[model samples]
Target: MSKPIRNSTEMTDITRLEQANAMMRLVNQALARNDLAALAALGFCHPHIGELKQQGGFRSSSIAQNTRMITRLRKVGDTHAQ
Candidate 1:
């Protein structure tokens, strides 16, 4: 059997996953609000978003993961896009 992930690595992965999920939600909300400027501004600075915007195609799961991060950030008022 494969070795299990250490506790620290697992926690880090969970944190990153949560952040990605929140970002996705924020992107969706911004789109719904017709705030492309805000979306562009936000995505411009994000590593995954920037890469995706440049490439023009990304996996659904990757998009979903980032959306979740945006959503959570919005909920917590961490970004102005909301």
Candidate 2:
């Protein structure tokens, strides 16, 4: 059997997955409403949004990239909270 992930790593992975899932839901809502402004705020370019529209969903790469942004922004907030 494969080795299990350590607790810290598993928690990080779970957090990232949750962030990605949340981002996916927001993107879908924005897409359904044709909310370009909201999508743009999430770092999606016009061309990229067009492609996402055609695909009917954002790619994993896009989700991960945006999720990383969220993580970075959270870190900044945490630093301020200290």
Candidate 3:
């Protein structure tokens, strides 16, 4: 009953976290590849990156995380390089 409901809620949170991580990975890969089209499709652009860079707190954490992710992706080699 209540135990099962709690488990269900926890599972939902895990799923949401996984989804967010996947989205971040995709965004990082796109940036590494310099895939403007993919970035545009994901609603990311120079201004968005700039905003993230300028913000502090959670926003800053998010930006730092994303920047690291992109750097890692770039190091792995660009799959979409022109």
Task: Please tell me which predicted candidate would have the highest lDDT against the true structure.
Answer: 2
How well does candidate 3 match the true structure in TM-score terms? 0.49
Off by over 4 Å in 2: 1-6, 58-82
Q: Sort by TM-score, best first: what order?
A: 2, 3, 1
List of clashing residue pairs for candidate 3? none
RMSD of model 1, in Å? 13.1
Q: State the lDDT of candidate 1 residue by residue for 46-71, as single tens digits.
A: 56545545554345678665656655
lDDT tens readout by residue for model 3, 1-82:
2222224444455555556667776766665666667767877777875553344213336645655665555433333232
Query: On residues 1-82, what C-alpha lDDT tens digit does candidate 2 reach at each position?
Result: 5444334544566577677778898998899899999999999999999998999876667767766765675565555545
Superposed by TM-score, candidate 1 places the C-alpha of residue 71 at a distance from the truth, in angstroms, of 17
Please estimate how well model 3 matches the true structure, expressed as its whole-model Cα lDDT: 0.55
Worst 10 residues of 1 by lDDT: 73-82
Q: State how far residue 70 of model 2 sits from its true place (Å).
A: 18
